[model samples]
Target: MEAPVYTALAERWQDQAGLARLAERAERRLREHPHGDLTRWRDALSRLPPVEPSADLDRPDPRLGATAPDLQGLGETLMDLHPWRKGPLVLGGIRIDTEWRSDWKWERVTPYIDLGGARVLDIGCGNGYFGLRMLGAGAELVVGVDPTLLFVMQYLVCRHFGGDLPNYVLPLGIEDLPEGLGGWDAVFSMGVLYHRRNPMRHLRRLRRLLKTGGTLVLETLVLPISRPGDLLVPDGRYARMRNVWAIPGTDRLLGWVNEAGFENARLVDMRPTTTSEQRSTPWMTFESLEQALEPGDGSRTIEGLPAPVRAVIVATA
Candidate 1:
């Protein structure tokens, strides 16, 4: 059977040019991927008893509970999909503490963009957490793209509880999207630019995905330097993350954005990541930000690089 998430998205976006093809390609890729745990995840998701989701997107808790009858059952089913990375999701009164304080990121982002009735695309959206928040902020539709199957499953669980809202997270990457298929009013590329091997290509692609005068909300790890050309090309990894290719300074980031054909790019916010914002919890038991930091200095990463400091830049496409 086709996943209800995909079916609903296909039906709703069928008339939108190029959306149907993208959805079809995403479905095909999902089927071909060898995800051995998909069946178990699906079973766990099916066990979640239906309840009217009470989404409090404006608050720190983006909850999905409302006097649920089977709180214990809901918690148990949610735990079956462990290592929750991007949430502090409250389901049936149980707080599934995630690895990252995605709420902090949301708080930093939501203030700058006008989501009202905007067609938004979230690149590398993990579990559709921010997408849900965008919907709550009055976005017309939110399309999140990420290649990870586990995150897709996690999103499915939220979708099931959140009801048939106009938000969809596809198991595909930014590269999977066709170029010049512009319609989105706002494009968000958070925690994703550093992971791209070619940051310029990624930026240009984001520009192509948006309509003229569209907003691009970009948040990524940045080096704490004042120079325009200074960028840290990690020899191997940055903060224990292997895929991080480049960490640019604020000026360098702006330069890149302007060079990528974006206009009026300006850094809006920059803050060092805190242990309080990200730490190991009962729901996410894996090594976290606290563990990733250097034991002696606490400011530098375990690899002796400058600690993770993120910057949010708003640009015009």
Candidate 2:
């Protein structure tokens, strides 16, 4: 049986042939990358009580539904999906304090763009948190793509209470997107650029997915460099993440955005990531920002590299 996400996509995104095929491909991809604990996760999802709660996505912690009868049991079931990274969601009266205070990042980006009735594409969207925020900001539709199956399941947990909103999170990577698929009003690639080995190619791909004059919101780690074209190709692991391949200076990032066919690319926000923004919580008990930084000095990573300073760049495609 097809998931509700695919069913919703078949109806809401029926006008787009590419999205239709994408829905099919996404199912196949999930089948290929099946997780061992998927059954357990599904069982927990099945255990959720039938309650269609009202959602308030505009708040710092997106509030969903009121306090239910079996609040303690509900919280335990939700705990089955551990390590919640992107949110501090209030679901069915239980507060899920996630690893990252994603609200701060959202606040930084919201003032720069207008999502009123816009069609959005969010690359590397973890459990559709920003997608919900986009809907709250008046977006018509939000299609989020991420490779992590765990995040997809987390999104399902949210959907259990939030109902079938327009915010859909597909378990697919940016590379899995159909080539030449354009016409998005806005495209957001947050905390994803540095992970790509080829940053320029990734930026170009984001450009190809946007309509002419569409908005591109790119957020990624950066180094403090003097030159416009300078970037750091980390020799080894940076911030305990092996997949991070490139860390560009803000100027170099803007230069690459302009080179990749985006017009008027400019940096809008820049701030060093702090422990307060990303720390170990009950929902996400794993090592966090504090562990990644140097023991005595938070100014540098454990590997002696400069600490993570993320920059948000906005451009016209």
Candidate 3:
């Protein structure tokens, strides 16, 4: 076996279920969608507004069976150590253990990607794990943009770990994004779209970043159908940590994305990373495990939703 892709982070995470936006079953449904007449959703992709990606989806990993990431690199517990892709990918900066990669970060978003020779952009690239993963898979140029100083610091940390070595670059904000850059093969606005100051407008930028056929992947929380909600105003603390707004449901959210300049986009996956009510804590990040609610490290907390409670989409421009 070529080792797991995100195993390192999986091991270090003290919290097994702090986040709930992305889940595994979504991957299952995505891969098997064709065989099961899930074509309604599958066909929706072609109907989405055509935007050609200036880049390309990273190549699929030979290790993981489907679209899932084999993140076995995240171990070794050195917050500073970067995970590098071995033979298939020549990435070596920060090493990521499966513990870290298996978290909601990789779970929800890693499945629908093909990053070789594509111009990739990671909004709110946090510690830069996902972007690094894209680069390892073969994205020619992976640009990670974030508003925080920690973004730079974490890039350093990832670099210290060789996480920054692959074809990757970290910039400040979208405004800082290099101009004349044609567009992206794909854009992963993952944990940030819901938290934006003006989500619709921000989404337009994401769409604009892609050519007519590019994929725009999004992941966020959703409200139950019974409880229709327009927004999910997080407690002040959560807002302060992320510094943006959040919605309670996926319908309104997806509706807005379509309104911004998309068509036929559909909800493809919904998984519950955790069901904790502690949205007000910093630990609420994908890295937290308040959901497990157990002492000691590596315990897991799970939610009992028949379908994934979180929602993900591969909307097109």
Candidate 4:
């Protein structure tokens, strides 16, 4: 029932008392053979009896355009969805962006969100690195929502590592945004909105989930300026990419945040990511700074701005 119990029962049948007996026996056997396989040395662990799997793990909400994010049957689901990260795909000429690990995501990003003693919502929390970190750092409550099986499976692993047993990790999306969802102090979404078909719709939905004066912290790709006007995400966008709209400039981003019923919209930082990197790494995929900004051309998106294809936006609700 408890988180540790699952891992323990699944692997270690030796109880505390059994451990003591094993230790005593090992001490006695030390003179005979001190260094061999531990499995050879210990009393065998008995198999744990199986229990029925939770039906809720596979439950789907009605409105999400995609299927309920499958928390069950995830091993294969993840392999299919995350094909970029492994296997025979590696031998082909194709490259996968592998730089998802970051100096910022672990250290700077989580702390800046500041979830301590606060109710927090992490939209599309893939692998939930922030949720685990927030719980370890003392969040009063933390809820992570994501649409991919890979993200949910990783979240389940991370939660157990944080010590609380899971009730469930529900699959959810912008279309299924819960009613009466306010009263949270903060909402954090990073690198996820762009994947949606309607990013502005996703922005507006954040307002439904935040308390008055709550903050939304986001990191995303923005379009570099070609001239005085806004740039459209060129016409032939990928098929599975439903929305993939690129906010033309920081001004447009700030405008959207304000329109979404938020004040104090601001651009916090800018940096180059894997957008242009050869796609060997699984995580580093992004709208590369070079291609996005075309920095070499001495180009500016508008009259005053230097081209920064990606930007971080932090706004108050």
Q: Pick the candidate with the highest TM-score.
A: 2
In terms of lDDT, the best-performing candidate is 2
Backbone clash pairs for candidate 2 read: none
lDDT of 4 by residue, 138-245 (tens): 565555565554444433332322334322233445454446456667787777766766767778888878888888987776765444565456343422233555
* TM-score for each of the candidates: 0.94, 0.96, 0.56, 0.57
The parts of candidate 2 lying over 4 Å away from their true place are 1-3, 225-229
lDDT of 1 by residue, 220-275 (tens): 99987643357999998788988999999898899999998899998999989999
lDDT of each: 0.85, 0.88, 0.48, 0.47
The number of residue pairs in model 4 that clash at the backbone is 16
**Which residue pairs in candidate 1 collide?**
none
Model 4: ten consecutive residues of lowest lDDT: 55-64
How good is model 3 by TM-score?
0.56
